[model samples]
Structure formats: structure tokens, C-alpha cells
Target: MKPPIAPYAFIAPALLLLLAFGVLPVVVALLVSVTDLDLAGLADWANVGFVGLENYRELLADHGFWQALANTGIYAVFGVPAVVVASLAVALLLNRSENRFFRALRAFYFVPAVTAIVAVSLVWGYLYNTRFGLLNHLLSLVGLPPAQWLGDSVLVKFSVALVAVWRGTGLNIIIFLAALKGIPREYLEAAALDGASELRKITSIVLPLLRFAILFVTVTTVIAWLQLFDEPYVLTKGGPLGRSTSISLFLYQEGFAAGRFGYAGAGTLVLFLVIAGATLVQMRARRFDADH
Candidate 1:
């Protein structure tokens, strides 16, 4: 008991930091969400009053908020699967190759993951310009019509999703590669001896064994999709008739741009709850799978 208490003493500092940096801010934000606090309210305390659920009600009714939610959902629907499959495919290919040169390939795939998103977005913005973009120029070489990539409302959301997939796939590739390498060689050998094809082995053995990693990836991708802001902000500015606006972008517009602090806080809280619920569902599914 004394030794256990000594271990807890070492953990105390990290726990304290979490409370100060994480817990305290969340509590303060929750309190702020219930009050009608704006910039004026910050300067003059009497202007702030308890507005209760009004903020939440207005947020739910707001068309911009709903559009943002729909856009985020669209992003997650397409982006997550594309990233997951692309990453898994890259990892599989890397895992099978036996050359030192292939190790360099891993670095190439991971480079975008570590690169600054702002810088990448700016560069990609130029690449997506309607008239003189590298992509459109290349398309012209193939006798294909140039697409108004970032300027068309119909294509903006999908275009943004493509960018998200391009940027996020690298991290997922690394994760899946790690998981693939962790898989026991004995399983592969045994399956081979049983005359199972590579595809069959992957379908029956590899995928099932990699279920936990899949769950983790899914949960993280969903959360990241919901909080999408940076790419759309830098590239599209939620433009092309606001087709690319995400929930986080909407929250930023309300809180910082529009100065509707309390309403933005409420929206943030709602988004928080949505993410929390998604995480909970993932945990429950994982638990159920483990039990089975």
C-alpha cells in the first residue's frame, strides 16, 4: 500500500496539469455558455445575464449551423473511408516489400503528415486556381475540360474533402503500417500452408485482427471531421455559396467573428456532446466486439 501511494505521488503533477489546463477551462466555458456574455459584457459585468437554453435553441434553428453540420457530415462520409482504405493499401504494400528503398517510401508518405497544414493549404490553393492551376493545366494536356475546383458550389465540398483526405491519409498510413507490422508472421505462414489466397488471408485474418485499430481510426477521423476548419478556412473561406462550412468554422464565425460568445459557446458544447457521443459509441462497439 505504501509503495502504491508512492507511485501515485509521481502521477500527481500530470493530474494537476490536466485539471488546470483541461478541466478548468471546460468548466469555465460551460459556465460562460449559459450567460449572455459578449465583449461589452466582459467589460461591463451587468450586461451579462443568464440566458439558459436560448442560445442552444437559436443555434439549433440557425440555418448556417445546420449547413455546417451537413457539410461536416459529407466530409466524414467520403473522407474517412478514402483515407482509411488508401492508408491500409499503402501500409500493406510497404509491409510486403523487402527493400531498404521501401523504408524511404514510408518517409515520403509521412512527410505530408508532419508538414505545416497552412503552408500546404496555401500551395494547394494555387494548385486549385481555376485558370492557371497545375492540375487544370495537366488536365488540359489530356484533352479534359478545366474544372472550377474551388469556385463552383457543386464541387467545393467534394474538393475540400479531397484535400482533407490528401492531408490526413499520411498519418493513417503510418498507423496502419505499425498495426500491420505488429501482426504475427506465424498467422500468415499458417494461412499460406492452408492454401488460402493472400486476399482471403487479408479478409479473414488481417482485417479481423486489425479491428481495434480500425475502431480507433474511425473514432479519430470522425472527431477530426467534425472539428474541420483549417483547410476550408485557408483554401475556400467557406466559399462557393458556403458549401464547405464546417461546425468548427461556424463556431469560430459566431464566437470570434460575430461576437456572439454565449451562442458560440452553446454551439461548441453541442459539438462537444456530439463528439462525446461518437466516442462512447465506438467504445461500446469495441467492448462488444471484445466480448464476442
Candidate 2:
């Protein structure tokens, strides 16, 4: 039997886009990573010299790289779970009602995700301002001193991650809501008839059924956090003694700021591997849990 031509025709454009934007960049980065390609190399290909794994070796020893890696890990550790739980909770609440008000509320919640990152960061920047800010004004009402949200090294990680988490949850809430809608109403009715509490129904039935959605959200959330960039870039500028400098930011600094493209490419490849490994581990754990 011949396969339908219509499906392939529909997918052809997307496949071409992925190959050009996604696959091609990775391949070029891989090639660049093996050479000592700097700003000069960009203008003259003859200046490029292959350095083998030297770039990787230097990256491994660089304290800045390690700090950036650690910062990214911290962001993921705090941001991923927060986004998942907050989005799921919001979805569960919103899913309870389908009225006009609730429908409008869903759109309101998703505003952060669609808004420009610069605009969101600017709003948050004011909120995090040390003085003459809404947050500080609120604290002054209680006779408390103003806290340095983005200025303190220790507090900067959470400050930056919080913005990302707030921005990230909007989309995930929609995903969870979609998954929640797919769940059969019969299961809830049966549980209700059996004298199960709302909490009981959710824990034993709703959550169990939402495992696939939960897994999908978790893996993607982890990947997003690992590549943390925009919020930190715009908010703190990876400042306060580089405490908020994520791996992605570090690569940006090296590649463009310092004109060390090859070194940055090596770091890019490492970051890619870390993302791939983390995703695989999550998926395998989910599979294992399902089997058990």
C-alpha cells in the first residue's frame, strides 16, 4: 500500500526549516569547535587553525565556565520544579470552571509568556529595584528595610530564576489544562459515588492519568532552565559578581564579546550534550516508573 502524499506535503516545509535552522547550526558549530576560529578567522578562512580538543580542555579548566555551569544548574534546580508545580496547580484550579470569567482568566495568565522578554524584564527590574520601587514601598509599610533583590550575589540567582519561572508557567499551564480536559469525566463520577474526596480523586486518579503530561512538561522545563539566558541577560545582565551568569550567557560573552568563537562553540557542544543527557535520564526514569 502506498502512503498518503498529503501528509508528506504538509510536513515538508517544517522538515526543511528544522534541517536548515536546527541541524545546520549544530553541524557548523561542531566543525568550528575543532578549530581556533576567532574574529580574524571570520574574515579570512586561511587564518583558521585546527586545535583538536584544546578548546574543550581550556573550557574544562576555566573557573568562569564552571561558575556559569553551576549557575545554570541552580536555575534549573529551583526553576523546573517551581514551574511544573505552579503551572499544574493553576491548571487544576482553572480547569474546575469553564465560565466566561474563567476563560478570560486563562488568557490573562498567559500574558507573560507571549509578552516581549525585554518588556517583562523591564517590569520585573522595577519590582526588584533597591529603592523607590513598589516592592520596597511595600516593605516600608511594614517598617522593614529594602532588600537588594538583584544587587546581592546570594539573592540574584533566585531573583533571576523567579522571572523565568513566572514567564515559563503560562505556557505549561495551557499544556496541563489541555491534558486535564482529555481525562474522562466518568472516572471522577465513579470516584465521587465511591465517597472519594476531591483530593483523593486527584491524587489517585487525576495525577496518575496526567503522568504523560507531567513527564512532557518536566523534561522540557528542565531543558529550558539548563539553557537559561534571557531573564538573566535582561534583568541582572548576569551581574552581582557573575552569580547570575548562566552557561548560555557565558557562551555569548565568549563568542561575541571576547571574539572566542571556537571556545564558545566547544562550550555550546558541551551544553547540548548536557541537555540531551538530562532529557534521556528523565525519559528513562519515567519509563521505569511506568514499568513498575
Best by TM-score: 2
The lDDT, on a scale of 0 to 1, for candidate 2 is 0.95
Q: Poorest 10 consecutive residues of model 2 by lDDT?
A: 232-241
The CA lDDT at 57 in model 2 is 99
Error of 1 at 182 (Å): 1.8
Off by over 4 Å in 2: 1-6
lDDT for every model?
A: 0.87, 0.95
**Candidate 2 clashing pairs, residues 3+ apart or interchain:** none
**On residues 1-292, what C-alpha lDDT tens digit does candidate 2 reach at each position?**
9989999999999999999998999999999999999999999999999999999999999999999999999999999999999999999999999999999999999999999998998899889888788888999999999999999898999989999999999999999999999999999999999999999999999999999999999999999999989988998878988899999999999999999999999999999999999999998998899899
lDDT of 1 at 60: 81
